[model samples]
Target: MDETLKDSKKLISDIQTQYTRLSKGQKLIAQYILNNYDKVAFMTACKLGETVGVSESTVVRFANALGYSGYPKLQAALQELIKNKLTTVQRVEMANDYSDENTILNKILKGDIDNIRETLEEIDGEAFQEAISRLLKARKIYILGMRTSFVVAQYLGFYLGIILDNVHTVRMDMGDAFEQIVRIGEDDVVIAFSFPRYSKKSFQLVKYAKEKGAHVISITDSLFAPIASESDNTLIVKSNMASFVDSLVPAMSVANALAVAVGMKEKEDIKEHFDDLEQMWDKYGMFE
Candidate 1:
């Protein structure tokens, strides 16, 4: 689990439990959050303090009082509370509050940059190397991600398939998700992509893979995420919300890194495979 994470529900409960002991300004801040957590989840410390009619310092103190390292960790706890619960309409409403047309481009790009930065800073290097080792040794690899997560899974599967054989990208259109992975065994590896609005189908498949003795690797936003719990190796890549959509650039970047790293390990074999592929493509005129 992310050492930075406080249980979302417990955080709220603690706030209520300590309401009577809070200073007058802290009580106002707590009251605002208690009633409007969804709104506060996306706010900056300065913005939250301003909304509560208090100085930003008071907000930081309030977060510290709640046992968080700082205001950002507290804000992140609040975000976890509503991450899966927020509807698309609610996300769009939040987008309106956070950005305008004039600033949308910069705001979204900045958020994506921050996501990558945090992912790079917080992701476990040892776990990442271990995941690569597992993939290299696996008899077969299965990849699954539903909804928006499918985009990331597809991208990773495409590259990994080229680098290594027997890579399966599970798609619901082909059959039931369970059927797609039913043959998983101890020698197999299942890489699951899970992000905000986490997929129940994906989580179930990952759990099933674990039960069948397959190695599980999860590329997700947090270690506390459902799929992460089932994974043998959890790759924590940040996907902070950017407007109505979850920012996926960070996840894609990591996927690319993984593919490249794996490809480099089998460089001679891949070179020969690509050479044959190029000849076949030339004979068929597959590309202009």
Candidate 2:
């Protein structure tokens, strides 16, 4: 197996290339996986073995034969392969198969914790700093995120707006997302939030920003993500599948961190802005 070929899309090719040498038991596992990867990606090694009529050890051996360190790594690769491709119905089905109703809470919480840990470990510090630097220097910062990702984009835009005067949260509700960023230029920074089931509009927005000579910063789940290729700086954040919805806990943490980092560099300005806002709110009796 070519160790350099780690892309999830190539995993299938790798298996096919090595199929001639696989044992009968390994072949069964591979065949089942090749046929039902979306389901197998969420299955336990034991479950996969049972489905293929093989022993658990055979499944583990199959994974090793495919060049993964263990079954978990292979499973992750499978998940990565189908993450953006799974439909909502398929995601719900996969979640039901993987989680027991009696322990759904425990499994979900633990999974989210693991996602956060992985994101911390994998995040690029240089990219993070460069994103901050660009945000600080940008003549205008446009934030784009569609569907569920819009929530995180809104939060980031809100905080960045407070810290900096030139933040624009691209509102798809107003009109076309492209129209919102049509004026983007070399002095602009487009910070895009994209994850699995990635949006076409978000991808196009970033691509246009890059073409216009603007700095594009992508906060997404993988280096292999479409937006990453169009970005000046890419921040990888781990996101988990929570039934039909993609969990954004770690993505939100990254947004919060970016806002804080930018704020830290302009604390004096933030303090002044907040102080004036506090006075206005107090005068208007906005809060008890």
Candidate 3:
């Protein structure tokens, strides 16, 4: 475990255990930090205070209450947590001066490598394998994502279609989503994605899918995310970032792994399909 993450986990666990003892101002700071750990990690004391409607002194007091020497110490700890949690592109962006391209490139490369390394470390291999198995066995797979996460849904739908044949990526059209999900049944599986500032419509869709007896799989940043509570299995992807935009690299990687696992599991079937495509490609003179 990264030392920073270890500290953060300790802090969070401590806060949860002793929450009732916190002062009102301290509780506000705690809630803000817990809800927006990435933002708090990167923000200045003045900025965090402004957002939380608290004074800078209060922020410092809150840090002290958490057993830190002061606000800067707490900030340093948060920076480490962010570094451990954020994606490569995100961390690079955080670290860069923004005016220097060469420096930015180096940082970006380092961040990507670190992101992949940490992702491998954080993922529960057994749970992931079980998700793949469930997906493979499902009679149909319904992928649900909205807003930024829709890109993930589309990618999964496209690749999984080549292998699974019964994959559906829900469109943004609300009526269409309702109509499609209504038809899902007990043997179907629903994979839903939502993150911080999660979509209400996505939650509703997950609920509807569950009501229809489909197994729900959720990919989200928080265990407390509304969708996670209802999911048959939830894959937690760390989406924390310095800026407003959340990174999708981890989610995309998870989706890719699922597609590959499913394809490998049905290798004989996929091989026949690809073999037929190869002959068609030769016939059409599609490639040199």
Candidate 4:
């Protein structure tokens, strides 16, 4: 079991309580660290300051206000908190606190809840919005996911096609996808979903799309993913859970969010499309 930190949650909550008391520079540092905890947890004070558009002194001040000796101690504590809470492999496995049959349900629910919550907390809002915008504007949208992730890709493709035209879901057949890829142009976009133990084919497809000048957005679990290196924008969804099997809850949530954002972007079009479908269904007595 991981050693309990010295009231880390209380410390974080206290910092949050005094949020309004922070100076402008310190506030910037504080907000940045809170929003990007995963990144800041491992970063040095100078790197944290640079990333947040603040000075090193500002980072130190923010640390001191949080009741730490200095930035390093605060960073260490934050790292421990992150290591305990974040759904990464090493941290989550080490922190597993469940056993027995009744605890199985609790574990699953907690894992799903944690996955969604951490994903939302860790996501970069600007990046997410930008990805939605790109998908909305693209002439053709191609979605690729293999194995378990295929379900999310299919769901997105199905809903997105209802809202917008020219949405393609790439299947596992490499030849079929290759043929489809040839038709994609600079104005097109490809959304690829791949997590840890990522499919090589997904990486290849993303690379192929990039080479063909298609904007590629990747939804993945790690910065180390092969697809991430080739992706135009990567949305990280931390899906670390108990059991070696991956969970779909976080991926589905992200896909649903993307679908909603895309639908909202083309609200009128989606409305008209659904209206026509309803009319056609009634005319054919399809529901009766």
Candidate 5:
């Protein structure tokens, strides 16, 4: 890294450091980025130029002035700065601003569409396959999700439970976290979910699972996400913000895909489980 851009981690501070040296057009772009980096992170160079009323060339030049190779590097640094810091209240406010042109429903749905598109484009196929392999070989599998992510955990656990004989869903409640994870052993694997405004307890739980010798696989929004950073494997999911909600659509899609993969891997056993389950349902007249 160039000395001038070494403070990429300190985006705000670097902006301040370079303030006096920036041109008038650069100043405008710099100020907009500092004030609205969360929004800017997703903008294309052309979009960013439009937002700041500069040419795309100007935007690229501003990035070079900051000692970055190009606009993408600068934008990525901006993302890292705000990734875990944006609050739900802030997201709601952003949604309000973005929903002006479209109906709230359309606006929100479009955001989810973008999220799923981006997630699919960037998902690391190798890591995903490794995660499936880990799940298949583990002596037991523990699924964890906390707070907003609990739904994702339950979805994964319920589907995987039928495919794997030894599957457990570890609740995020502090009281239950330890009790559930205490017995995790070397041959076990833990699939954990965590997203923005990350839970400290989940972080602690993943760490504990690691200490207990479980192979940890994380499903999260970013590689920099605390849980993903510490895990042996991570599945990256794109989460969009819509009215203070972290869109779970992409996360759920990832869950369903993983479940199907695991099921196909254990098709013989799962077929038997389904057969028995079908009989039980028939016996109880459980269907509508």
Candidate 6:
């Protein structure tokens, strides 16, 4: 990891610090990136150069001038910088900025596919295994999500609960969410879900959980996410725009994969638990 990859650090600061030393073209690229960082992260060097009316070589040189080994590395640093910094308005504007591309459905689907691919690239396998290990070993686990992220939390909590009896979800809508989380302790684990247009309330809940000394695992879009900064383990997934809604396909998939991985890790016990659940569900006709 490079110095610019620090989640808590702002890449804009680096750009500004080097402003006096940059060439005219380099300054142009830096200014454009600073202005449209959220959009620039997803664009290619060619696209960025075209947008700024510069040659691709100029962009590459600009990245080198910024102390990055290459354009892709510099792009990654910029992405890490603005990953969770965009406001809802910025997201809508960035989405509209690219609205001229393909059909709506095609764009949305392609975006989802790209999100999954980016998630695979950004996510760390070792961290994933560590999360599964910690989750399995925790005395109790609490999961929380707000807004669209809540659906993913619910899905993960539901399956995780079916496998482990100590799983709990802090449902804010039910009004007792804090009551459940107020008892979080050293042996407890809290898994939080957050995405673009991140919920301040959900992040507050994560803070509260941390205050109570629970180890937190954050599933979010970027390392720069506030929740990630607060978490014991941060899983940076990818979710791009799909019309007005935030594309949570990759986030949901990450949750599902984590749940399944945990299940596989405790296969024997989980299998027995599921066998009983299957019998009970069959007896009660829970599914048609």
TM-score of each: 0.95, 0.95, 0.70, 0.65, 0.85, 0.83
TM-score: model 3 vs. ground truth: 0.70
Deviation of model 2 at 241, angstroms: 1.0
Q: Which prediction has the highest lDDT against the true structure? A: 1
True-structure RMSD, every candidate: 1.5, 2.1, 7.3, 11.9, 3.7, 3.1
Clashes of 6: 0
**What's the CA error at residue 201 for candidate 3, in Å?**
1.3
Please write out the lDDT profile of model 3 over residues 23-125, one tens digit for every residue: 8877888888888886677778888889989898988888777777777767766765454356656655665355677775675556556656667777778
The sequence of per-residue lDDT tens digits that candidate 2 reaches over residues 1-288 is 112226477999989999989999999988888899888988899999998999999999998998787898888888888898988887777766455665887877888899999889888999999999999999999998999999999999999998898999998789888888889999999999999899988888899899999999999988778998998888988886877868899999999999999999999999999999999999999999
lDDT of 5 by residue, 4-26 (tens): 22444677887878988998989
Candidate 4 structure quality by residue, lDDT tens digits, 96-185: 445677797887788899889978887779879889989878999999998888989999899888888789899765566777677888
Residues 145-229 of candidate 6: C-alpha lDDT, one tens digit per residue: 8888889999999999988889998887677677778778999999999986778888888998888888999998766677987
lDDT of 6: 0.82
Once fitted onto the true fold, the runs of candidate 5 whose alpha carbons sit more than 4 angstroms away are 1-8, 35-57, 67-77, 98-102, 172-175
lDDT of 3: 0.78
Off by over 4 Å in 2: 1-5, 97-102
Rate residue 17 of model 1 by lDDT.
93
TM-score of 2: 0.95
Worst 10 residues of 3 by lDDT: 1-10
lDDT of model 3 at residue 242? 30
Which is better, 3 or 4, measured by lDDT? 4
Cα error, candidate 1, residue 252 (Å)? 0.5
lDDT of 4: 0.79
